[model samples]
Target: MSQEFESIWDAIEPTVGDALVMKVRFKIMSAIIRECRLWKVSRNIASKRLNIGVLRYDQLLACDIASFNIDELVVLSLKAGLDVRLEVQGA
Candidate 1:
């Protein structure tokens, strides 16, 4: 038998809430990474622009989701000049 999941997080997370949080984090992280790439700057410069350390920037680039929290990712996105928005839907 096999199971199908809507997302990787859904499969790995023990609860729907946990999966939702991870999904949000991944979305924000992806936007930041996209902005960083569009800037065409070196890692050092990118880190400085985001006001985060190089290692942290590396983690973001590497998609290390567990290393970050929602608040931190939101701040990083703002620092990267990306607008963050929230949409709520009833389940």
Candidate 2:
């Protein structure tokens, strides 16, 4: 493999992963919002449940969730009364 190709892959891989994570996080946030409405819990309260600050929660709600890892999202989902499930398909 050429060095240029490897460099491109290195750049693209993380971008692709971040895009995927952002999409998943957006979906998770949608679900969390639904649960919050049903439970009549405010974002501030939800942030506390997730052990994060209200400001951070606001940023997350504003779609700045790329900074959070999958594990953090899983924990947030659980805190929002969601059950996280993982599925893997073999190549």
Candidate 3:
């Protein structure tokens, strides 16, 4: 699913699923950036590790959640030393 959104609320398909995914992606990105800052991790180093531009990584670190897609956030989170996991439970 290509989530190349112009705004955080933007989506490829205006469906509930897309919106939920966007919010989850935003939260995940926020958590990664928060942890990175807490650990004093340099954005430059993270960018190098993620093979992304320093500015782009800086944006990620700045909590610019709306600027990134789901796949990009996942990659950034993994490179930020975070383990990605999914869970399912009765809802």
Candidate 4:
């Protein structure tokens, strides 16, 4: 199994694969963000595609270094890593 799968499974349930989990999380996050009325952004297919892990990390990193999918896996992994910068400062 890929390292991505290791992190992704740990972030979410093993039963729900990374791709599906990413999609579901995106939908939920999108709805929450929409109702917040804070950002004027809408969920795009490209963002979802990025979360799909269609391309290897090396390939993705080579071209667009800013294209990391900050979805559930990344959030959980960062939290696990004790990366306080990723934490909400005040709230």
Q: Model 2 off-target regions past 4 Å? A: 1-19
The Cα error of candidate 4 at residue 6, in Å, is 23
List model 1 lDDT by residue over 1-91, tens digit each: 9999999999999999999999999999999999999999899999999999999999999999999999999999999999999988898
The reply for model 3, stretches above 4 Å from the true place, is 1-14, 89-91
> How badly does each model clash, as a count of residue pairs?
0, 0, 0, 0
What tens-digit string does per-residue lDDT give for candidate 4 at 32-81? Answer: 33332332333343234334343432333243323435454344333223
Native-to-model Cα distance after best TM-score fit, residue 1 in candidate 1, in Å: 1.0
Give every collision pair in model 1.
none
lDDT of 2 at 53: 94
lDDT of 2 by residue, 1-91 (tens): 6445334334555686655665666677777656666766787777787789988877767756556666777777888779877677898
- Better by lDDT, candidate 4 or 1: 1
TM-score of each candidate? 0.96, 0.61, 0.67, 0.26
Clashing residue pairs in candidate 3 (N, C-alpha, C atoms within 3 angstroms): none
Residue 20 Cα positional deviation in candidate 4, in Å, after optimal superposition: 0.2
Q: Which candidate is the best by TM-score?
A: 1
Which lDDT values do the candidates have, in the order given?
0.96, 0.69, 0.77, 0.39
Between candidates 2 and 3, the one scoring higher on TM-score is 3
The pairs that clash in candidate 4 are: none
Which rank order by lDDT, best down to worst?
1, 3, 2, 4
Task: Show the lowest summed lDDT stretch of 10 residues, model 4.
Answer: 79-88
